[model samples]
Target: MSDDVRDSLIPYDEIVQDALRAVVGRVLSQIVGYDSLPGEHHFYITFKTQAVGVDIPAHLIAKFPDEMTIVLQNRFWDLKVEQDHFSVGLSFNQTPSILTIPYASITAFVDPSVDFGLQFQVSDDDDTQPEPHDEADNDRPEVISEDGSNVVTVDFGKKR
Candidate 1:
């Protein structure tokens, strides 16, 4: 085999990313259909706050300027799932707010009860650049385990 490499015309990386994001949509749809999370199952969805199509309160954007992780647990309501995005009502400091997040903006999803997780690459939106945030500074509950038991991470490198 030669060391030379060639780029394919198909955008396989983007296709696979879309497919994985659909998994998150399907799972959220099931929860919405049931009207609640099953048993102890819940989700920790981390997304880029500045991503396009993300509609969050100004306060939240101020607090989490780069990225934010929301826990879909006991207090969330109005769980609406769309083909490419989801909207849900949550409270921050006793103030209720509704957030709409596009699937493309999501960087991570996890269900700690089952130790399941999925990590995605940031979408290629030339208009917006994602800012990095330190995980140590985040206040959300830890969802990914260190044992690496059931977590699924998908990484498709840039197409050359």
Candidate 2:
């Protein structure tokens, strides 16, 4: 048999990416509807801090300097989830701050309590671009953690 690849007229990549991003929105909607986290079901969401429509606090921006992870449990208010993004108010060291994050900006979502997670591949055309660094620095990804609860990572390396 001859080995030949066939192409179809379906944009599967874009379709799949849109659907996966919807999962993030749906999950957030469920949480907002319930008005409280179930049991110990908290989320550690990591997203591009510089992406469009992201409204993280100034202090957090200074601390993170890149991306930042936020917890959605115990002390959060004004949770609103839209089609392309979500917004919520969270407190940092007893100070209230409002944050708006687009779903596309999200790179990782994890619920380590159940060993469940989802890592997404960002499109090259997205407005948010990775920071430029030397080859040595590019070899290693930066890890940021707060309280060592649930962890998720977004690596833009080719799969081996």
| Lowest summed lDDT window (length 10), candidate 1 | 130-139
Per-prediction TM-score, please? 0.84, 0.69
Model 1 Cα lDDT, one tens digit per residue, 56-85:
999888878888998886777889999999
| lDDT of candidate 2 over 1-45, digit per residue (tens) | 333343436766557667777888898898785545788887767
Clashing pairs in 1: none
Best by TM-score: 1
Best by lDDT: 1
TM-score, candidate 2, is 0.69
Clashes of 1: 0
lDDT (CA) per prediction: 0.83, 0.68
Model 2 clashing residue pairs (backbone):
none
lDDT of 1 at 23: 94
